[model samples]
Target: IAEFNSSRKLIPASNTKLISTGLAIRGLGPSFRFSTRLGYSGYISNGTLHGDLYIIGGGDPTIASGDRMTVKTDSLFAKWTRALRVAGIRKIHGHVIGDGRFFDGPIENDTWSYNDLGTDYGTGGNGLCFNRNIQTFSVSPTTVEGKVNAEVTYPATPWIEFRNCAVTARPGTGDNLYQFNTDLAPVAELRGSLAIDKGQKKESFSNKFGALTCAWEFAKYLEKLGINVTESPADIDPYDNIRYTEAWGKDSTRTGFRYGNMAESPENLTLVYETKSPSLKEIAKVTNSRSDNFYAETLIRMLAKKRTGSANYDSCKVVIIREMDSLGVDMSYGAQIKDGSGLSRHDYIAPEFFCRYLKAMSASPVFKQWLYTVGIAGEGTMAARLQGQSESLKHRIKMKSGSMNGVLCYSGYVMPSPGKPEDDMIIFSIMTNNCPEGGSKVRSFIDGLLMRIAK
Candidate 1:
């Protein structure tokens, strides 16, 4: 390694996903898929579903968002509608419930800063998630100074409300808005102001109720199809009151309040329609390509839930560490991973440990799939990056970029340069924390360093 401080524990930022995604690729394999099921808890009598219409969340990230690779429109609702029709059910008499119990515990990470909680990137992961757990708000400049106008949230969540306190600023001031919301709390507030010159700006904010949103959206779709839904979409929070048994694992005292209402299990639910997400390889492609916090967290928690029967922060870390240890990578080498998204300040990892993990994972059968998901120099999150690199140079490098506040990190593989037969490919890890000059400056420096290393 060019830098001698490899053993020093630093915030790997989004680089944390590299480790988690690698674990997923090797452990879960490339063909693993997340499945969401559409079923009914009660009997289907002639034209009516006597009990709850259950939309069970299997932690599928691509339910509504079209696959990033194929660009196929997600006709999820249409598929469900057809299934319902084939089942001879024309009406749902009971509540349309969203069940996302695959993963348990709180929605938002307890370690995440309050500042990051409301932004789209900080949106927490759950068993049932839809629309990337995001809410879109459009703001317009008001004619009166210091007063901005915000439109109602898109996709229209009637259950949740917004308190717009944003103001209009002078031209050239730019948008300086911040949104605040909690995992189960329905209300949100928009604070700060937008520039008057900026007309009709749309901003994306994260929310805690993805399953609710998904069910709500599907209910609306069913209505359009002349299939009557009696009540609005709702979610049954299984994690509401987790039994405090020691065998359940995790500290019961640290468990946060579970949001939403609780309902009886849909264990005996009859199948109606089912949706399968793109393979894990494709998911890793999107998650790493965009450095998606939601997907990363989901994958990690899913893994934890599968192995430990719990998806809380502590359980996830336990499982991840155990997985690495099983692979002969001693996680005790100064690595502390609190959240999968790397948004929490509680996360810490030594460059040496990360590099060691990468090197070990390089020989995996699904390594190529994992490599292809990360952004190339001119694609995905890196679409506007590596400005001066040749196409060949760009293709030779695949990277996952991470930056938040004073932390910036990049970790991935660098193939041997063209025509350099004897040159060895490199798996590199670099992290810069508390950079006084900011993330861009650190990224520029890292870019310069990579060029020299690639040579």
Candidate 2:
């Protein structure tokens, strides 16, 4: 119904997921599923395996995430343990290796701010992701009034050391705790303060070494199941391996070298079991609804790998541009896609692009599935928004919201009336950058505008 500065590019924040998720739905299909495999590199004789046990990653983001749509960690580990027992693997004579070479290059986008790198939402996408690539800690204020106690509460991170530097603040001050650590760092420092009245709370931090963490957790689970593993869990760091570079060099076309091709594994590797992730449609729903950065990044990487034979951020950018062009969405007007999740301050796109993209998606064959993935009233990021509005009005508004320091954006479709057909839907995007107003005020303004539109 309106247009203002629509062609001007601005920071999109998590609204970038709209593009990433759409490309994923179009390129990978709604029914596509990611697979992670458990196999051994050596011969199993009697009751002992002579070589490393491998968890070959397929870049599945939902493994052990404990979401309503995904499996829990302990249950998944138990299933793996049972599979090992059924395979007659009473003992492992070598290390449990996490082979995460499915997706290559830096785990995180280089443009992402360092401050965000340590937080749970800032966690990078990784092959063989487990527990959503997050490490949770239980923190409580101490009796000393100035000190707090914190400890790792999940995935058994024996390899990591935590130094609690958090303090106890006055009542009603709330939790201000933050974790400081680099990617794959063994040490993490917890800094900030928690209100004494808040008691204990759970804080989450990014887990960059997802593959290694997964292997470590599984090895520990096996030990608990009376199965002995000789060596500690280890991960294959693609950046440090000479063979990785050689493999890339060998594949001049960069095709058939990653994702599904397990050429890096030993020829005699024995398949134990394989796990399949929820469909891409389900994953996209979670991504858009929750604004999940990890899921968005992984989906884009998977899309790049499928279309371009490479999974790095650069390849993902290329694939996105090509796909948008195919949809006749002009991105030439100062659109910059730095990362799939829009975690990077470098990502910029015009409001027009979002509307055009939404219109294009609405015309797609999978439009219903894509529409179902978006957040509605009282759901995901939209749960607390439009509070006083009627249920019918609220339900008529479906969109994805994006917010950061001074950025707030909403992009999606608004039904013209209750039970309206798809053709009658109105596509819209509102992007605000460097707004001086508080988030709550900005959100209220946006909500009012959307309410009017819905009516």
Candidate 3:
């Protein structure tokens, strides 16, 4: 290594996924699936679910892409209504039984500091996660007023409250403090602000994230999808929103169902729904390719359930450590995987451990098939940096990039290296932590270096 800057045990940031993801693939195999079961307490008769409907969650993480981080009964209600309707059922006159038996851990990682959970970058493990278990809020400046009006993709009724102190500021500095605290989901929070550098007075806002206030939207979406309006639905979210509603009609049907029918026990309704876990490899790619923290957290929790028989991250740590040890990857490098997405700064990993993972994945056929194909400067995360560099460097680089507030890292295979002229496989891991410039700039710089190495 050339003259370096500072040398200490650094926070690997999302690079920790290199360890979690790689080991997850090796420990659980790339083909594993998270299972959710739909069981009935009574029988279906006269087009009505006679007893209660139990939507059991075995930690299926690939629910919704955004705003699903905090699961609202409404989003799930919509799917349930649609599914039940399709299955030749009309009314579910019973309680929506939430069987969270799969995960008995706290909503937030006990190891993670409280400050980070309220920031919205972190996620909670729920039997029901919609829209990727996160909510989105878009703010566009009103053409006339100096203030901006924001809209949630999934509109919530008792609606998610927001205190947008964000004003239309000058270019390069339009930022606001995005924060939320819910009586619901006490262990987690929805945070991050709408920052605009250059845009007209009007901009469309959207994110696949959950807000402490997403209950209103979920209710709205469900009603639209044909769920008979039912007294505004209960706010059963993990935030301070967990309240028991008086059981309707003696619990005749399942109200809070996740809507995914188990392969073994599909819905008893004539119109049952088949909810599938996005392939494990597909979810893995989202993290490696874009370093999606939400997906990473979800997958880690899901895998944690499989590994430790519990969905909580604490138990996940146990499973991850055990599996890592079983994989024969030395613990000398020492890593602490607080969450899958690496949003929690507590995540760490060594460089050689990083490279070892990449090389191992490169050798697996299933991984090779699911791993993302880089366009150099053509598309995806590498597109911007490879604009001029990737042209002559086609097919030479296939890698995953990761970043956090002040870090940047990349690890993957380089098709040809100087050492082996014909066809040599090269795996590299580079991470810079706690920089002032932020990780995006550092990521652009990393892409530039990778393109140069491709030649």
Candidate 4:
């Protein structure tokens, strides 16, 4: 309210999640849930499925998160195995296919930097997102100085290979490891140093080829349960990679099978296993509170699929812009929305635009659900922020904070103080971009600003 640059286009950082999450709750409906269907496209005559086992993707990002963003591998997959057994399917003579057609976009957004592609924050959104597109590496220092070795990856798969070039530094040196790889590239390079720890250290890295990697792991799981997958992931993934990459101009090579197309019919094939993700409410909670880039990107694409029948990035942007227009928000406030995560430097939005969206959302039926997704005064990214506040103020301030390089942003709802009318709560957005002093300084400035506003 004082000395503000509300209309300046600036990088929103992760605060953009607020917009994507807000719009998603209204556009997709709070009750909407992402569903993944499992069906076998084959005949089972003598306890053996003669045709392919199909795993169709429904743009569900929580398949790997299990329930509520925690990994629940056994129960869900066990249901599939049990269903297969009950259906009299013991042996599968064909390939285990992953159908990712629900989403038809490039694995990596064009606006995302090449440097951000393969890290935990950079994992591309997929029609079939498993384990949140992440793989954890357990690392320890070797006897030799300046060298560290990595053990096995969790939910291990034969699809990805790692090249360890990490160095071990003296204690208190801290972690300096870096990963390099293309979104769907088969190999990843690990570089940098970590402070030597007597105890093994664990780090989670992202994979661009998560859908296929997850399918390969599922195939191995089926193999353990007496089912054989005759076809290798090399064959299936290349076919899929080709299909997804063609739109991005990364590959033009023709492939045999169209993995995105629906399998023949459910009558001929048995429904082996089906999984439904947490509702949109929970997903948006994780997106805004945790600042989950993958989920944010996935939600936008899902909206695009709902409106345009295609999950590409362009469609998503168009759909989002159109929705804002319908809501009477100025499109010029955020002239362009390149990616859902706000990871792209090309992304630009004015703080006024975010506040307008938040204000508009507050009037909607789903406003409570949307508000619940943001971090409260002392949770998630808001931890240690707005500390020592009055009890009433603590519960009333809900915000989503975003910081990337020189950009720091916060946007959401701040409820009314005691003695104030309930409707007096404010919707606000503050973004500081290109701050030479970095995130901590900008956040300190924001805290001071909030205190002044509160008084």
Highest lDDT: give the candidate number. 2
Question: Candidate 1: where are CA atoms >4 Å away?
Answer: 69-74, 143-145, 238-262, 418-423, 437-441
Q: Which of the two, 2 or 4, has more TM-score? A: 2
Output the worst ten-in-a-row residue range by lDDT, candidate 4: 243-252
Q: What is the Cα root-mean-square deviation between model 1 and the actual structure?
A: 6.5
Candidate 3 lDDT by residue in tens digits, 1-455: 22232223456766666555665665566766666555544556666656444455556665545322333454555665667666655544443444444555566665555545544455554655445455445566443325555544443212233445444544455544354443242222233333345353332222222321233343344446554334323323333222323222234222221222222222342224445565566567666666565566666676676666777767777777676566555555545567766666666665656665565566555455445522223445545556555354655666555666677666666776445664465566666777777456666676667665665
User: What ranking emerges by lDDT with the best candidate at the front?
Assistant: 2, 1, 4, 3
- Candidate 4 lDDT at 330 equals 74
In candidate 3, residue 351 scores what lDDT?
60
Cα-lDDT of candidate 2:
0.81
- Model 1 per-residue lDDT tens digits across residues 251-334: 312222223334656577787777788888888877887888888998888788778888887898899989898777898776
Q: Against the hidden reference, what TM-scores do the models get? A: 0.90, 0.90, 0.72, 0.88
> Which stretches of model 2 miss by more than 4 angstroms?
143-145, 170-173, 239-268, 418-421
Off by over 4 Å in 4: 66-71, 143-145, 169-173, 196-199, 230-273
Cα RMSD for candidates in order: 6.5, 6.9, 7.0, 5.3
Write one digit per residue (lDDT tens) for candidate 2, span 298-407.
99999999998889989988988899899888777649998999999999899988888888888888888878888886678878888888887777777888889899
**Candidate 1 residue 91 C-alpha distance from true site, Å:** 1.1
Candidate 1: Cα lDDT at 256: 26
Candidate 4 global Cα RMSD: 5.3
